[model samples]
Target chain A: MASGNKTTLLFYPSTTNVSAKIHPVVLFNICDSFVRRPDQAERVIGTLLGSVSADGIVEIKNSYAVPHNESADQVALDIDYHHTMYLSHQKVNPKEVIVGWYSTGSGVSGGSQLIHEFYSREVSNPVHLTVDTGFTNGEASLKCYVSFNLSLGDRQLAAQFQEIPLDLRMIEAERVGFDILKTTVVDKLPNDLEGMEATMKRLLALIDDVYNYVDGVVEGRLIPDNNIGRFISNTLSSLPKISPATFDKVFNDRIQDNYALVYLSSLARTQLSIAEKLNTAAQVL
Target chain B: MANTMARSFLQAVATEEVAPPLRVVQMEGLAVLKIIKHCKEFSPALVTGQLLGLDVGSVLEITNCFPFPTREEDDENEADGANYQLEMMRCLREVNVDNNTVGWYQSTLLGSYQTVELIETFMNYQENIRRCVCIIYDPSRSNQGVLALKALKLTESFMDLYRHNSFIGEKLREKKLSWVDIFEEIPIKVSNSALISAFMTELEPDSPVVQCDLDRLKLSTAPFMERNLEFLIECMDDLSSEQNKFQYYYRNLSRQQAQQQTWLQKRRTENIARKAAGEEPLPEEDPSNPIFKPIPEPSRLDSYLITNQVANYCNQINGAAGQSFSKLYLMKALQDN
Candidate 1:
């Protein structure tokens, strides 16, 4: 090993045809009491840059900023202070490795849980987590298998890893996740979403107006007055001239643009039908 | 001495059967002209038909009886020089006065039954009682009609004046009395001779007609006399232009008086209530009270000037006698002739 600002290592696999570039992953580990001592935490984090591999290609990075003063005797207290780091590995051999460590005491006395998640980039499925507990030292090992065949340009693979609406249950699961993705993916997605949102808000306002109008009509708040005539005239004026035709074409052509107008007209038609039926029933009675 | 002789002569004429059919005929003719003239004032259309010898319809017939219709009739007579004297006499006898006198005997009697029917029809159509009677006695009818109309017009004018005078009398009485007390006392002392005499003296200097028994007219007119005078004064006051300062003064005085009365009544009630509650009574300071502020005296000369002007105007419109029948009756009589 050459002691310099950069360091390099060459790995030769037993399989001759499988040649690969292995970029070293840098992990920064802090002591349980380090964050409690601001000076010690700064020293630990400040010294991390010197540990980088010579290739200067950092493939993955993970760090935990935990409150060091957390109590270790109480399980609830220990779990409260526990910092979690999630890493996804698509392929490669899985092995237990001491990624990094910091001293909690003069001797290794405290232990921690390690969790590893693996999944194929092509298919969307439940992530597989391998958790190994019961370490008598303040150290844990994690296995991350980076696939040799994985193309660095495949950002779409990360998108496919997103939770999709498969069956009804997944659809429910995606609601919260998609909401987050929607905000994050704003710059990444198409431009039509903004216009769609605006249109949806307007549609909701119009629907609310229709509901009020219907309620008013039902409650006899809407009476046959000058305003009623004017409203009808104004609404009709907004509509394009329709040729005499069946009710469907008339409704579709003239009223489809204004939901409130369409709803009112439909209500009016329904009332007219009811009135006609009543009249016929009355005559029979 | 002249009044006594005139009275004795009238008495003799009433008692004695002196055959003065010719004088009666003359009077009858005059009465017809008077009636015709009065009726013509109401509707010139009647005069037009009489003058032009045009056939009359039920509309004209009714219009001929009304002093004023809801609206003026069309086809009013313009020809005042036509010879309608005989025809007018006949019409008067036919419709208004007696037909048996010399001046009216040869005149075509529309017949008593037919005349009554025509009058009934006229009344039905005209509907207004005052106007209908006025037109019925149009001088264009005959001399008898003219005389009757003249008497009627005089009576109406007198009644109007008497009404104004009585109103002033009542208001004067109300000066010292409460409205409730006035109303209560009015019926009791209404026929009191002293009040009537005072009212008459205050209104007119020529108090009684001893020669003629006009007691019925006096008694019947007494209550209304002061009222009629007050009405006349008001009419005169109103007829004066707004520029007349006297009118303004009088109106302001009336208003102030009304306000003072209202204030006094209110204070009286408040005092009675306070006394009942054992509260101190308010001091009675008359002139200090805002409502009792004295009104400026009106210029009597200016008022007289305005009143004279209005009276002149009324006289001009009403004609020389200031009788309602004079203008209308004379116009109709001349037109028919």
Candidate 2:
């Protein structure tokens, strides 16, 4: 809460602390940068471009890789390149300022403080995102941290990277593409007609899941959760009430319209081809 | 790793004189996300970017991309935009990413991207890059639970005719090209690294599906259909106007033809009279006569684009209607039970 880190939590109250919400793009960007890193480099760091909301949530939306040379004893980042790239990104997206910095590796390293110290001057309480690109534990562990200054007497000696809560959020459009990518790894993507079947199948599966849970609770086989019951009922009540005849008519109308549209489009294409042919034929005179 | 493979492919292909015919546009998952983020962030306002990838054998792989600076309407800003792109690519090259300019991408609204300006942009790119694709992303259409991203390229035959500034019907017939031949859409394949795929698997909850999948089953598709209809009607009007231009051209052409016939008839009679009188006869065809001048036929490029737009809208409406029908029936069955 802001009681102790009041200067850091400018947008938060004393109770709920700051949390980091990352968009899928940022994670993809960090992974890309790590994949394209210099052959000898251990980690790749980048500037996180996003904005902080009034509720103390840092939403990272974009990022660009910053070339850095790090060793066991020293670390050097191309400060000029970072500033120039940030300015270039700013020209297009003025709203997304420097929210934090992201690095790829297992965990925070000793030189992270130096880099964090540099970023602190650029932004206050900047977030340090560590993506385990190494896949250390059979998976990449996404960890976001904030540093706290450790002072001995009056001199600040070091900054500690304290872990914070991180959540992954994606927009509807991104979800569509991500779904395709995820599915492509296992099988070929579905076309238009197949897409409809896929959607219906998923919906039916979800309904079955909810029905089973509710059925178990009703039979006293499983303990019922009030939140689950309310949510299920809410969705149930949202369905429309109509006579079966009216529903059949509406369904028929939809199918007919869809067929008509497809027919019209194909007809238009055929006409276009014919028109082109005739126009060219007439030009011969 | 895809990184080393992409680089080796680039080296192998860059040395070739003529690249093989592109069979697919394989895009890295990272590139797709970057495009989605850039486009969704600035919806309604048009945005474009550069795609950096390798043109491997029979497959144009898009490994990375960066957005261009949103420019002002001036020549100075135009130059600045170019410099910014170069600088950004330079910075990316320092980090060892794909820096080759394979093509560019732009966001559209409701699939209104089939335009002359788009063709002009392609022509501009053709000067430097031999093979490039223009990725079109429609943020508005993506609301319908479909990934509205496409890679388009000018058909080689169309580009050849376009370069000569000739959309003449005679040339089109000779080339056997049609309106639909103006652009070729290459199929897109999404590819990702094994590490990224594993990471994504970790991100999922105990459930196999995402929470957002519920939105796909919503029965309210009225807005999407309405917008498609609006665009379709506008395109129809544009197509008619294009047709009107041709009508006007043919009318004037007939008038000119009639005037030439009259002048020729009079000249023949005059020549006969002059011969009887032993004087030199006047030439039947006069180079200085205004009636002999040729009228340039209007180009059919605009109408071709309009037709393409109308077809795209119709296809979209059909897809959305089909999806909505399925959702509606599922709801109906649920209600009955």
TM-score of chain A of each: 0.17, 0.79
By lDDT, the best candidate is: 2
lDDT by residue (tens digit), candidate 2, B1-337: 9999999899877766576798889888888888977898789889999999998888888999999877689999988988898888888899888889999999999888998899999999989998899999988755555677888999999999889978866777788877778999988888887767767767755554653455565667778777788888788788889888988998999999999999999999999999999999998899899999999989878887888888788778777776776776677677679
i-RMS of candidate 1: 56.9
Native contacts retained by candidate 2: 0.46
Give the count of colliding residue pairs in each prediction. Answer: 62, 0
**Per-prediction fnat values?**
0.00, 0.46
